[model samples]
Target: MTDYAFSSVNQLANDFKDAIKNADDDQKKVLKKAQAKFSLIERNYQIITNLYNNNMVDEQRPLYFFPSSQRLVAGKEEKGNAKLIVPFEFVGKKLYYGLTATGTHDLNPMPFNPRYPMVGLHANALNTILDNKLIHEVSKAWVVLIIIILGVVLAFGIPSLSPVQGGATIGGLLIGYTYLCFWLFSSQHIWLDLFGPAITMAVGYLGITIYNYIQEEKNKQFLKESFGTYVSPELIDQMYESGEEPSLGGEEGYHTAFFTDIQSFSAFSEKLSATDLVSLLNEYLTDMTDVLLDNKGTLDKYIGDAIVAFYGAPIEIENHELWACKTAIIMQDNLELLRQKWQSEGDRWPEIVHHMQNRIGINTGQMVTGNMGSASRMNYTMMGDTVNLAARLEASAKQYGIYIQIADTTYQPVKDQIVIRDLDFVRVMGKTEPAQVYELISETGQEPELYKKILPAFHEALALYRNQEWNNAIEAFKASDELEDMFPGRKTNPSRIYIPRCEHYRDNSPGDDWDGAWTLTSK
Candidate 1:
């Protein structure tokens, strides 16, 4: 069969009518053949009209049609139309019997199904418009709300999950929301924003996930550079996992500050060769630094021949003062062993190097800790009066001929756990207020009870000294010196410094307004 357009079909119909009117046998035979061919094609391929015609009563539906030669195009608006015009696109394109793959221009019916290519699409559109069943999209407010909900839900959920799980979550949400879109359109003729929500969910998930990964990587690098040298890898991991950043600002915190410096280090360095000094210093520092970090101390810095550190920073340790005291004791114990090791390696340096001792100072109080330095170089460190006192205490340790000294704030926390001696309340240079400093002896306060009698006498002497009774204080201090029979560990005698001061005070009595606080003229 041949394809036909609305114009060609009209021309053929006219030819048949006029040829018969002219009365010619050959023409009649040609017309008869054309009519038979048209009939045969119509019987085989013509589709039933899908539109409810205005000419027919609404209750009386036509189930079948007798194909008419004049009605070539099923897309005609009416049976009584006088105008012969049609869309140019449909001029040569064949009208389908019922949407066949053989031809094009099948817009008559919807594209979802292959039926009624002539009248189905038009009838469907007309029916939708007529019945008020046109799908109306959800409001802009609803769309925005849905986007936000999906974006928030996926953004939060994705980062907390593994990559595979996050992908799966996005996929499931997209599919589920799309299904809801289809269901709403079918059931209630609603057109929700399926594409919008799906895209928002996927985009939000990926954006948040990637951002978190990058931030985590950045934090790993930062934490490594900031603390990698001193703290253990495990501690680093703990800090990193906590997800707290150490930024450039200070905050008040209760922490224990620690400082240490070798005694006569300048004199010892003078004797050692440059190479030997560096080698010895490296070894000494490595061992001591490990002990400090093991006790959860953040190594603030190394000053020439000293180590400065603190506990309860970057990460808080509950018993920071106790840790500081224990770390001091540990450092002393470790240093003794190291000295023995150096002695065994004879000729490494002067024999006097084996007797090297480090003085330690610790204090506990409210201090400021964070990144502090010039714009070019920032140091994650601590500052405040508490920190200053700890440094001063380190210097004062040498004055008392002792290894370690801590302020009263530190002593109160570890008195039960450590053996200590009450030193004195003295005003260091640069400060107006007097602070009580004590010497830390050992972890165990229970021992030979060697300083028991001397401690009581020393307290009495200190009390007398504080009362401006210089003669009585000197007498009490001398009795204390006589009572101490045990070998002094770090100091030659605890009462020596106090007695000299008491003798001087007795020789020249002070005027009124003496708070009994000795002020050191030097740092």
Candidate 2:
């Protein structure tokens, strides 16, 4: 019976060898045959052990076909079709090994065919065995650690930097990490993964950069829409550079207030069609407004035929009063050019349109300047007594037959830079305190030849009128008017307007306490 049992076991082993040789490259078939043969050997372990112990050559030979057996003398129980050994590729060859666990490492070959143990296996399989869960867990932990560190850095750091700086920082991190991984691998033979951490940082950088780009564009659009029509491009650029929004609340500051209106605009409105009126008004406004913006003035709003603007708010100008004075003269000069252009158009415009005139008033004082109105609707504008006086001056220019009127405050700071004439010392309709008003004639050295001829007699006439010498004042006024008439095509001189005033005062004299300050009853 023992002989028969030995024959059965030997026959089974021979059949397993035959199956492995016949299976060739079929690893699953070889594994199936090995399982069957190993199962029988497990059942008959005492018989095989006794044969091998008795020094029989065939039985004593090592069964290298069996996988490593630190758990048992033979195959481990693979219940539910779970494999105890696994197949892996090595050096372009297929081989099998016992599955790796926490503390087990066996690199010795496990042959598919017992006749040739080295045929289907490689010596490099030892390195493959070492590439196990332990190494993978360490690599994965390293990757996670790298990702966490870089994520924290990029989240906090990238936003503070500009686009170019952020990009360069990302580049430096990637290059530095790549070099670290390569150095570890080359110098220490550590297999730290490059692809995982590299991809994570790259994705993080791209996401942050895109988000910053979108937010920057949003801020830029907001600035453009908010201040585009009110402030100059240069001020808008300054706001963008500062990365701050203008305050919506009112602020009190020293500013120069400006107001302008077309002279006899009501007559033009009566004469022209609505479309032609709008066209003409738009052309005039565009030309005048360009000078204001060019000199860094903030436009407040238009009131029919009037333009209201200011300087030294939202952004401060170095010499805002001076700038306002310069802009007024430039606008008048531009109006003259437009008049010439309209005249050459050959009566497409009316004769009155060709002779279009406007009045400008400027004052410098403390005022409230900011976005004003309800929450849902607002206008960036100016208010206070200064602004009111500026409007009053604009309305009162018609009385003096003048084109440009400026308060004494506006004239004092820029008096050396511009040519101006003292028009009057008067209290406008709304105010209690009287202000000295002046006519802004031209920039220094740019006054007309006619001003040179009439100004001497005009100055004498003004002094006599202030002295209350009505008779001499009337004669001096007429002389100045005659001098103005010498220059043909001149507008009605201020001298001519004062003549009747002198006549009236001569007839009904002001009291002895009269301070030579006229009180205007109308705006």
Candidate 3:
């Protein structure tokens, strides 16, 4: 019976071998076709990489194939029992598969066993499982969708919530989810999508946080750019640290306004080439702006050769008028030094021989001050009659031949620190009320006695004029003008034009209710 069984098994084994041969032939044909297709695909990938000058790793190339072989082995004890084993290798990696079969004819593909004393079969099964897992994990759209959702939720939700609350929630969720997934995957051999969702969420949160931090820095940069030009660096630093932003509209405030312009800048500019002209102007503006900023003033704007600036707005300053007056004196002193330097440079210097003479006017009043302009653009500035009056005072400096003049209101506060002469009390070209103009003659150290002598007499003359004593007032002014001439190198020469105007006003008596104020007809 056993012999008969052996014969039967042998016949079955032979038939099964024939079947395997036939299957092998069919598989060979299929492999040849697959190889051709894979070769074409690999060539195409190489062509693309070459065109782009890309040096990609060989493993990264997508075209790949697996070559496998199977065999049947008969067992010694049982007639019909035999073993089937399949082996596979790819890219230098080995794979193996093995299973028990009743006969070669009944042999079939089977699940792998790692400890079945068949290394090739074990390796083949492992490779198959790994490949299937990779493909399945990558191809599933639901996994990708979940990753995207998690990324979105992390990015948008984290920053919006309080830091404490958001961080705790995210930390707990990540820990619990990761633990659960790992437990399931390691113990039950179940694969879960881990890398995509976790990586996406982490990157999204980090990206959003970094982006917000960058935006905050940009805002700080913008603030520095906008206001740094006007205010002091210390003040700007304070503003930035305080986290308060400047408004784009004007606010009413009590401020000390200062205006300055180069005397006869037009004729001087016309003499130089455009490049030299710009350079010269820039030098003067830069020097003056430095002085203004040092004194904590807000530079409003530059009107041609003029600089209009103010103090005690955007930020409050206690002694704004004093600072403004000090700035003017410093500017005048600095100009003298600059002029000497230019003169020493000799003929190479431009023919326009400018002496760095400046006319400065200051006034203290309630004015509108802020950044004002269209939605797209704006500038820190001041507006109102006080600003206009300050400008008019600068213009009037040419008539008085003075370096600096201040409205009576502006001078009233800082009169002790400065030596000033009451130059005039007349209605400016655009105003009905009389504004007393004072010449800022000197500071404490320089020309104190001369300023003292000149200012008293000048004030007496102004008092005479205001009291309607014409003849005596004219005599006082003539005396004052003479005294100014005696000090030959005085910063500003007294205007002869004013002598005539004062004489005319004295000769013709203004109306009875006249407050001894002269009217101006032109700007």
Candidate 4:
């Protein structure tokens, strides 16, 4: 049995041959007769263990061939079959066998693979025994402890960080925890199940990240639809992320209102086809609206050729009245440029194109502004006396033959910032109180030298006309008439407007309490 315990089957066969060579001629003759049977049975038994990939029975020794236990003491080739054991390539010392494990999945064999499937597990078991590194598996209570510790800490920590910071935090925690598990396994032969806690943190943070992404997209879409046409996209995005989301309700605050209308727009539309009308209006509105939005005005709604807008609501603005007045001034400048461009088109447009004009009005006062309407639909707009006053003033601009008009309140704060001339004190329809209206002369206070020379005489004429000095007022107004050419694109002049009024008042004057304010009879 001892002589047969060799590494390879060929080595054992050589030992068997040596034993037969030492036999006498008579014993060799008997051995040679039974050699074929012995070789077949031994090879068949060895092949059985490798076929199943496991050891089911201990190998038997050839004791019956020796005939007695006392004869087994002698060194002979006495074995039923030599047991095969898998070991390391260089290991020649101790070997492990019959390793036991519970509830393990079967080693699934793959085709075309030359190595046995169970070889890895066998090597691991053998290594554990050799290195004294068998794992002491963690208990149910230990796994639960890990879950509670990590879950409670991460729950409070993740939401306080931004998405990138939160992701980094979660990644760091998982890597650190895995390191701890590996450390315990190497140092103390302890194995911990990281799957439960790893899954908990992953699901928690991933859910939060997904929810935040959805909310951010919602905010961006809301801002784009609500304010894209009225302001810069960057401003809208910053306003949304500022954490003060605007809703339906409003706060009480002083604000400025603005209104504008194109003169004879309906008559212009009658001369053009629908497609041509839309193209012309699109270019005209885009130019005027760019000026309005550039000055930071919130566009309300368009009524035909008219636009209604306001400032200083939803978010407070500094000097909003001046912003409103400046936008009105810019509207006229852009309107003039468009008129020149259209005039150059000549026969490409209708005869009405030569007379393109716009009138604007601005007023400043306290008003309610918000998203106002039914529950199903609402519009962000202003309502109250200030809004109506601005609209009335714009409508009344045509009566005074001026392009831009603003209430006294709008002019007060912006007095030094803009060029303006007093138009008249007029009692607008539907109101008992009369407002002092001014014509917004220019965006910048800079004026032509010709205008500066004519304005002094006009102011003198206006003072005399108000005081009922008809003859002197007529002479002063006539002296200013030569400067009318400086105010281009108009068939009428200020002196021409007031000379008839002064004549009518002079002939019919007997009233004692007239305040000299014009009472407008129509819009």
Candidate 5:
């Protein structure tokens, strides 16, 4: 049988070679001659023709030699192309098929026949192309499997995960899929679609990622629009990070309450036109509010020309009282600068604008701090006696002609850091507790020369006044009042406020029950 096969192969091969050489690479002529030669071969031996010069046999339909008609015919288009990388090995002195260990199959179809070497080379190239087409067709099922796998996993998975997690999942899937395809092709001669599944995963991840990013930005914008004017930016960010909205609730905590009002806001309203008043208030409030936020205080609300804010709610500071005091001082200094600027702007503003004065009152104690008001319209604010006292202190500051007044509770924590003078011991309206009050002058090392000069005399006068030494206190207060004129910008002093009070007490004594705590009769 082997001998017959060789004889037939030799005869047919010789005819095909002659036909090929004569045709001089004309594919049609070669195919025509191949068909005639192939007719004499056994029925089982079929001729596979690669009609296209390129090795991709499956790109277009393959062509075949029909021995019965001695013609080449094109086959139906298939799923894959003929471009496989066939494996090989060497055994003994001959090259064999690398798929088997025993070297049972030869690399060339006719290994021993050397007369038609060109025929063997052509046969090997055609065999490789055919092998590639077979492998490609075989892998179609796997291609569908991968597409379904990636489509199902990524489509369902990406939406449930955060952007970072989604990206990681897509990357992991791509890496795993790539490795799988590479292993199958290199080790098992399987081909799988690489770009199709990868594209699916990337598109799914990107679509979800873009959606998530937009949602986050929208949430951030909402928070900014809702709370940007009232809450500090840092507090707003903290609220956002916590992923919870401010709800209606209250909790008691030790905090500092702040209240500020223009010294004569009503007068200004009466003096300037409505437009001019709003413009001035806008400028003044903007600058002062900037100073308030810079010091980490949360703005509670703006009641006309009055500003209400607090420290140690939603977030806490180590020493909230100290921060509240510092904020007050900075605001006053800022107002002074505004006053100077308004004064320099000529007569655009009334004389009061040139010396624009504001009063700030700060008190520290247990207070209820949280989102307050009806559910439909709520705000973050403070309530209780501490809050009331702060408001009262702000109103009463004008009585002493002082710009800043802090309760003794607020003064103690910041005593060493701030420069202050004892103002009075008084029970503000709506409260029975007679709290000691102090004037917040300046920072510790930054006190003015006049303040340093007047502090001693003022403090002595306060001690005597509190001790009920009314006649002596009056003398001390008068002496301190005299020192105010020595300063260049000698405005009214708190000492001048005390001198009259001491004179009243000396003339009309409050019986022995007077605890030296002056009780306020008005709000």
Candidate 6:
């Protein structure tokens, strides 16, 4: 009997060794497969970690890791040994064992199965069914629906209440929900999906807030780009802060349009080298433009040597027409000073023997003013018949020899403050209705006594010319030209050109229907 027992013990030891060898080989293969699969899952885990770390989904909790020291064992009846234990240090926490006939039969002291109760088969079967039913119910479609509805109501309803009430409502709900979920999970071993709805709410709110912030910044940049040239920087910032965009479209308001160009600039530029001509133009335009800016006029556009600008609109000035007229006079005055300075410095200035003067034309009327052009290219400008008339008057100044001319339409409004001499009534180039052009002689403060005296005589001559007394009008113009410090030396010759033309027309009359208004056939 002792020999038999010893042999049996030896046989058991051999079987155990064989099993260990096979299990180790199987474990290695299983571990290699697990590592490969886990490697793929680990990469996904890293992506999730990075997203969470970046606060991409602020309310979602990060994943938890089970400790590496934990282990799992199998075989319920094996008292002092385990079939397999993973991460062996956690074995002491509590080893879960599955009962089987092999385990009870091999270690012959008839080990008990912890999984079974002493109760009959029906009771065990009933408990298994209950556990399965509970899992199924928890994972049902209705359960997911409930969670979604709860999230929506909380997110929308909380913000609808007063601030303090909303805060209290949300806080109380969050605390109660968290506590309930924790208690259910710990005591009943049931898992609740807390993170999903919370993440949805957080992401939706954050997305809207971020989008609005970006839009606001874009609006600020647009405002700065649009109005920087016309308004002060501080006021621009204030408008941006207040979120008000200035209307850049057309407005119905009175404004003065000033158009000016160098007389015979194209012919003059042909005589000089390109570099010298460009430099000269730059010098002249810079001085003139500075004067325009000083008078609070918007420099609308420049067409080569010509400057087209306006007063009022974009920002309104009460004396817009007055400002425009004042700027033109100042520009003429500045040019005289510039000519003297250039001559003293030994610069080759353009000849003024025949005619070389800036002829400015101003008109006040309704015009469509705004940024006008295609989507890709646009310019802030004023457009209408009034703008065209201003240009036509500028061209007309060359014909009649005047420094500045305003239409009768323009002169009517500011007649109280300005002294003007009616030069001519002509259907200027493109229009059928005759326009009376008047030279802006002086302002109320700087009215020259000589201009005041000769201006009345010139108008009387103009009235006679309109009535077909061409010979008498010529005599009056010649006398006014000779008046001391009246029309000046350079300007007198150009005024003299019109007298010979009038004499020729008078000699060969154009019948009773002729209105005595000269029409320009060509530019």
**Which candidate ranks first by TM-score, i.e. highest?**
2
TM-scores for the candidates: 0.61, 0.69, 0.57, 0.65, 0.67, 0.53
Query: Which residue pairs clash within candidate 5?
Result: none
The alpha-carbon lDDT assigned to residue 148 of candidate 4 equals 90
- TM-score of candidate 2 versus the correct structure, residues matched by position: 0.69
Q: How many pairs collide in each candidate, listed in order?
A: 2, 0, 7, 1, 0, 1
- Please report, in order, the local distance difference test score of every candidate based on alpha carbons: 0.78, 0.80, 0.72, 0.76, 0.77, 0.67
True lDDT of residue 403, candidate 1? 82
Instruction: Pick the lDDT winner.
Output: 2
Best-to-worst TM-score order? 2, 5, 4, 1, 3, 6
lDDT of 3 by residue, 213-302 (tens): 898788768877888777878767667766655566878889989999887788776777888778778888898999999988888888
Candidate order (lDDT)? 2, 1, 5, 4, 3, 6
Instruction: Write one digit per residue (lDDT tens) for candidate 6, span 457-483.
Output: 666766766677888878876776665
In candidate 2, what are the lDDT values of residues 18-124, reduced to their tens digit? 65666647775655756575765554565456555665536333333547643323344454232232111022564454444434443333445323334224435
**lDDT tens per residue, model 4, 292-341:** 77887888888877888888755667899888887876787788788788
Where does model 6 exceed 4 Å of error? 1-224, 227-253, 347-356, 484-498, 501-505, 508-516
User: Candidate 6 has which clashing residue pairs, if any?
Assistant: 71-86
Compute the lDDT for candidate 3. Answer: 0.72
Compute the lDDT of residue 84 as modeled in candidate 3.
Answer: 29
Worst 10 residues of 6 by lDDT: 80-89
